[model samples]
Target: MNTRSGLFAVAVGALTALGLACGGAESVDELPPEPPENEVNFPALVQGVVNGWTINTSEEFPPIGCGAGSLINQMRCVGGNCDDVGAYCASAGATFSDTYWTSYFSEEGTNYRTCSAGWWMTGLVCRGAHCDDISIQCTQVTNRGTGSCRWADRQFSEEFPNTYSLPSGWYARGLACTGGLCDNLRVYECQLL
Candidate 1:
């Protein structure tokens, strides 16, 4: 009887050990999965509208009125001022209205121009129409013109106050375009010639 009791005690201890091992394995497997990394959280409306457009650390252009009927027009930053202006008549569906064009910097020597109508905005300089709709190649203009002759993407973000340090994998450079003109990656500083 004593031997039988001893045998029963041994069996009970083995069973308890088995139970504890199985319970530990189950607990480990039941742990929740880790959350995804590098998630971007933004509102639905902003994400939808800004999708595919260039994301830069600069103010968006306001619309402006041009032509006789005050037609709402689109303009691109060409040179000088933090927000310079140039006629942007691309059939590629670019458009701007008066809400897009506004004074960017208050520095006295900065310049801004509109290509659709020749106009320059220099501090204390008489505001007058100095450009025309003729698609003047900024490269040909010897005097520093308000409009940048560079490509759109290059000129829009690089000039003066809009300048920003590029990310690690990105390089700031220039690309030559039609008529031997080069546009800077930051469009605002794009110069003719």
Candidate 2:
């Protein structure tokens, strides 16, 4: 009878231990505080840049066409330079020119080849007030046949060692500087074009 009572006590103790282990002492009041009001919206904070590939595959270089010889044979180039056989040629050329080529290379299957003969405008923002000249470099990998623009970390200037406020109604579009004053400030006043 004493042994039976001991066994019952042990079972109750085990159950109590299990219950305490499962139900921790945490309360609802211990949660983290809410975020501040002035913070930027989550969508805007993680918004993708519009400057990436605006276009992809074109009619001339249909997706999955194989190349022939020096010219873009059968296969349609997708992403790079159109001039380069292995780059993304679809979005590298001008919209009008790409459209023309799309019509010109109108073929059915994986038998015909499209050739890029003229100069395709490399979608590179040139060094100017509207571009960060310091962050200017060309990527070796041609999309179709042209090299893509990349940001090279060649420091152009380090003159003013302080936070300079942008002019009223002007946001930083681009930044370029040489020796002394970091003057070239490309400002965009919410103009979309």
lDDT by residue for model 1 (33-52), tens:
11111221211111111112
Q: Which ten residues in a row have the lowest lDDT in candidate 2?
A: 99-108
lDDT of each: 0.22, 0.21
RMSD of each: 27.5, 27.0
How many residue pairs clash in all the candidates, one count each? 24, 22
The lDDT of model 2 is 0.21
Candidate 2 C-alpha lDDT tens digits along 24-59:
112242222111112211111111112222222222
